[model samples]
Target: MKDEKTREAYWRKNLSYLAILLSIWFIVSYLCGIVFVDQLNTIRMGGFKLGFWFAQQGSIYVFIVLIFVYVRLMNKLDKEFNVNED
Candidate 1:
């Protein structure tokens, strides 16, 4: 009853975070890499075009950072919901 509802709520919140993060990943990797590449190429970043950098390195870096951020956010969420594994 209450426990099931709590679990569902937690899962919903988790999914919401995933959706937002994935959307950002897609936009950075695909849109910046290909779709808006011409526009992004006009901007230089450390000797590389912005679009090229995002395609080759920036997106990967962002994904890694997102992983850490997700872990931290989930830890806080778990604590808030009294579901911390610790």
Candidate 2:
């Protein structure tokens, strides 16, 4: 880093990204999968209750998507901060 201020900004942006992504994962896995399970169960998906699917598989799928999202966001952030390897 060229200076302390730039390094701090980069770390701050990275932490913000982590916090946002983790919150999304928490909402999907915990709120949708467990807390709102009964309400979600009213709907069906692929022969399984929506809640059950979320509790079993949907969260996993969302997590995978979020992983890609985080990677993409980080790549952009890296380029913005001129820290990208490329």
Candidate 3:
């Protein structure tokens, strides 16, 4: 019973982190790329439009960084919750 409770809590924590990471990803890409594109385009980056840069390259880089961040945070969370695989 206690084990099941711990497992459930662990999942809830992990899912919350997942949701947050995904929301940030969406905001940085979809919201910034399509919604505020014109406003962003006003800013130039090495001859590349800001919106275009984000749509093409910036978002990918952010996603990569997000992945690393998630991994690092998840590891910490796992340790905190005593569920780390290692």
Candidate 4:
């Protein structure tokens, strides 16, 4: 934040992280859970259809994992930018 160039670079990295994380979430929740559900359904998991599992649970799990991933990434970014609270 001290320098304009640094500020811009920090913001760009932040946005890049958001874009990548959101894309992953979207692909998991939409593509795997819905778009490819039929193909996934052909597979079985613990007596449940893989596609159904994804539509109902897998996406949620992946989302939670992604959230942690984002937090970790942001924390690292913050440190790199000299903006971390710790």
Candidates' RMSD to native: 0.8, 1.4, 1.2, 1.5
Candidate 3 stretches with Cα past 4 Å from truth are none
Residue 4 local lDDT, model 1:
97
lDDT string for model 2 (20-65, tens) is: 9999999999999999999999999999999999999999999999
Per-residue C-alpha lDDT of model 3 across residues 1-86, encoded as one tens digit per residue: 99999889899989999999999999889988889899999999999899989888888899999999999989999998887898
- The alpha-carbon lDDT assigned to residue 68 of candidate 2 equals 99
Q: Rank the candidates by lDDT, best first.
A: 2, 1, 4, 3
Q: For model 1, state the Cα shift of residue 83 in Å.
A: 1.4
What's the lDDT for all of these models?
0.93, 0.96, 0.92, 0.93
| Candidate number achieving the greatest TM-score relative to the actual structure | 1
- Global fold similarity of model 1 (TM-score): 0.95
- Backbone clashes per model, in order? 0, 0, 0, 0
lDDT of model 1 at residue 60?
95
Angstrom error at residue 33, model 4 = 1.0
Which window of ten consecutive residues has the lowest lDDT sum in model 4?
Answer: 1-10
Q: Give the better candidate number (2 or 4) by TM-score.
A: 2
TM-score of each: 0.95, 0.94, 0.90, 0.93
